[model samples]
Target: MTFEFLLAFAMLVVASFGHLGMWIALYNRINATGLKRTTIKRIEKAIVLACGIIPLLLLLIELNQHGLVGVLAGLFGGASAWSWLTIAYSVLAGLLGIVLAPFWIMDRPHFAIARDRYQVTSAEDLNPLKETVKNRRLYLRGRSFRKMSKLPGNQIVSLQRNCKRLKFKNLPNDIEGLRIAHLSDIHLTGQLSNAFYRLATDWIAEQRPDMIILSGDILDNEQSLHQIQPVFDGLNAPLGMYFVLGNHDRRLTDPTMVCRKLCELGWVDLGKEQAMRQHQQTTLRLIGNEQPWFQRNPSPYKFEPGRTSPGNEWTIGVSHSPDQFAWGIENRCQLMLCGHTHGGQIRLPIVGPIVAPSWYGTRYASGVFEKNETLMHVSRGLSGVHPFRWGCLPEVSVLELALL
Candidate 1:
């Protein structure tokens, strides 16, 4: 082929990749956010038609045409389309990051400490849990949106076990070896079964965490609560089990009933509340802040770091969304735990997480981040709205807090 034809072909290839990336980013945003079903469906249809069908038609038209005019037309059209698509994606992404600039900047400008002092001493990946009978029924017969996503069988059953030993300078000496088993986004709907959670809890029990904290999205459908109630009840933690209401949990028909069920199972409902626990001679304060997105009451409780004396107490904040990390820091919390990003549910090798729902995008999407005195750990989460997980795997975080 001539140089002109090669150039035209290369432009078409680049535009196709750009289109795919844009759609993938959009889909990730939909999965991360709790949008209405109708809205999501409409968006999906549009993406398929515009990004998929229209491009194919354009390519076919270009191929059917003849001579230098056709080649030049294809090159110019492809280049123009790619430029517009890139600009649109960048503009939207930039706007989101800009809006959350305050929270992102607040977490910066921290005291520098030795890198070795804060390290992952141990990182272990647990085995995948056996799929339960109920899980099979749900995946095969459930009418959930995930079923319609056309997820692969392996993606549905795959789970990543992340047991990390994180050491930080701000960790208190008394609770220095504290192990907190963090589980989040356990969207226990028809797609996932109680047995999946049973295996997770059993594994956690084996680790013997001092405390167990669930960040949010415990129940997807209110009806499935009965099946998994026993699994959650069976969880054993020395300092007891604490939970915060996630956006999905709030979407339930009777969100209060869900909290009541957990409370009945002996789990503390830490929604918009604070509790203190004494581990040996050390006193630790735990605060659960549920943002007002879907909450019914949306408590007016505020955390004022200046009012409370640091004293000998260590404060830990828990929220369903990592967006609360800034609030936690302002409240003088030494450590914060969160989920809800689901690690973008699909991460690329070099590009990382393309779509994280948080206002700051994927800044605090997953893993550990330390900003000054506050250290936040975001779990990949146990489950997600979509059954398919590409590079991102479902995870149960076993955090071991240590002092420098």
Candidate 2:
């Protein structure tokens, strides 16, 4: 037989065995997981479907290149080097894409159903659990996890705060009815519609916030900026709509463009900057730092290239994650807002999230934690990549801080 025939035969043999090996690996993976039989079956089917499509499409392409009558000739006939390589790479990449694509693209909306399972007994159940009077400032998180269909929502956590002296001199004494709607962890991909933004804008407007603080993860892509702007345009804030960037936003091709687009629509980009005296009778210093992704450090102020004291201002330092305790402590921020972990989108019973990207595990995965009298409220965030909600449901925080 010709060398070309031998090569084609070898390619076919290797590919066939490789495909079988991959299928066995997939089967083993499904069986190894603690998921139910139905889930395992579904996964198995998905793997088979992916495998089937690749070989079928390649066969069709081969047929097109060489008519049925010339199938054998075409297999052995010399093709251009580039064309041959392209076809070979396409097959390899297509196989890889089929295998990994499920992790990246699976849109199981189980979290929504999971939210229905949770019953809130009281307002306290919805709020973070606090043991001391000092911990009255509750922290609420938005849905930030990309959930699988069967996961539970976020686990409610609580912490105690000790305040020897209450410090916000400029803060309004009548801050009882004062409301600030905190929205964070909006990973707005291009799929995000103008309507979602409208819903969010309207929700905040209905809350009648004296101020709105958007923590971070503004956009999944720079293109998403255009889609989200019209919603922000309608965001009617008497004080101002403030914003900070998250790690995801920093991954965009041009994060500055995303920032500029939001700012153009009346939101202030607070990264490494401050907005003073925006509120009545109060010097509300809004401080925002860049995403930890850029600095290669999760701690906000630890590796910050620029150093400046937030200075005895009644400041609310906005960050994407609670990685920076030093910045919050040194600044003496009365309140800090953050969102990144979607509360591990899929949460097990008491074991919590299967995987939470934060350093503190599931402890600080969601809700309020007080560090050195600084009350930090981490919003779970608005939307995530995966559609599941598990233990944590989607949230919109209406924070009312009654100063001690």
Candidate 3:
């Protein structure tokens, strides 16, 4: 192809990518809302159809009105509503966005496995820790999900148990080596078997966490509520088990029922209001925020760092989305636990995670992000509404807190 023709083709490709991204972002915003599954699916279908049809129509119009050379000239000459200048600028913008947002991990700044203050001491992959002694039928069914996800590059069953030792700038000396098991986004839609969660919960007991915190999206449908017990039978946290709700949980027949069930199983309900608990000699102020979904009451947090001292008390914020990162900072939380983006569910090579359901896009899709004095750990989540994952695997974390 001639230089001009090749340039035109490349420009079109970039602009097309940018256009698709715009639509995807729009749908993502809507999906983040606590809308009905059927309604969201309908809107998604419409958006996908529109994205495909619009471009095809534009191409056909250009082809019919202008031949090969004519079409290329029209593309370069600002044909119809899409001006050549505008298209050129959009192409540049798309390229710039692709360079960073997801692919911005090259500096190893936020993407580092070990930050300056924290280091991951042990990372284990536990798909089959052991057989579910109590439930053979359930184990076989849940294992079937693996067979379904055997497609190329699918890491649906690759569960990572990452133990991270984090040292806050103001961590208390007494609380050193305090381990907290962080599990989130267990979207129980019955697609994943109960035996899978059973082993997961069993492993939590093995960790012997001082405190246990589940960061939400626990149940997608009420049908899976029965499995909650069978799956999480032995979740015993010495400090206490605290949890919040996510947008997906709201989709259940009764969101409060899920909270009640988990609470009945010994998990504290942090979703209702701000709570302060004493773990050892340290005071932990847990703030739970489920905004834009089941948020009718005002936040109970004082939103002041002076209210609590890190030496004696540490504030920990629990939310479903990393969009609350700023809120955690405002509340002077020393650490935050969150999981809603599901690590974009399916991360791509170079691009990383692109389709996260967060206001900040995929900025805090997963992993530890530090800002101000608050350090946040966003879990990749054990499961999601979608059945499979790519480069991003499901995660169960043990965050070890210590003094810097």
lDDT to native, each model: 0.68, 0.57, 0.76
The sequence of per-residue lDDT tens digits that candidate 1 reaches over residues 190-247 is 6665666665777788888999999888887877788557667667788988888887
lDDT order, best first, reads 3, 1, 2
RMSD of each: 6.2, 16.3, 4.5
Worst 10 residues of 3 by lDDT: 129-138
lDDT of 1 at 375: 79
Which residue segments of model 1 deviate by more than 4 Å?
Answer: 1-73, 76-153, 296-311
Look at candidate 3 and tell me the lDDT of residue 115. Answer: 63
Which of the numbered candidates is closest to the native, going by highest lDDT? 3
Per-prediction TM-score, please? 0.74, 0.55, 0.84
- CA lDDT for candidate 3: 0.76
Among these predicted structures, which one has the highest TM-score?
3
**Per-residue lDDT over 154-232 for candidate 2, one digit per residue giving the tens place of the 0 to 100 score:** 3322211111112232346544345667787766764334544454566667767777888877787665666666657
Tens-digit lDDT track of model 3 for 1-404: 56655776676776667677677776767667766778888998998897788777766765666656676675565343444444565566467546543544442224632367678898887544233444334443445564656566666655787889888776776678889999999888777777677656777889899989999898978788897887777788777889999888878777999988888898888878677778678887888878767774446567455555446887889988888888888878889999998988887777677677776667687888888898988899998867578888788989999777
Cα deviation of 36, candidate 1, in Å: 5.6
Model 2: lDDT of residue 180: 68
Among all windows of 10 consecutive residues in model 2, the one with the lowest summed lDDT is 157-166
Model 3 residue 180 distance off true place after TM-score fit, in angstroms: 0.5
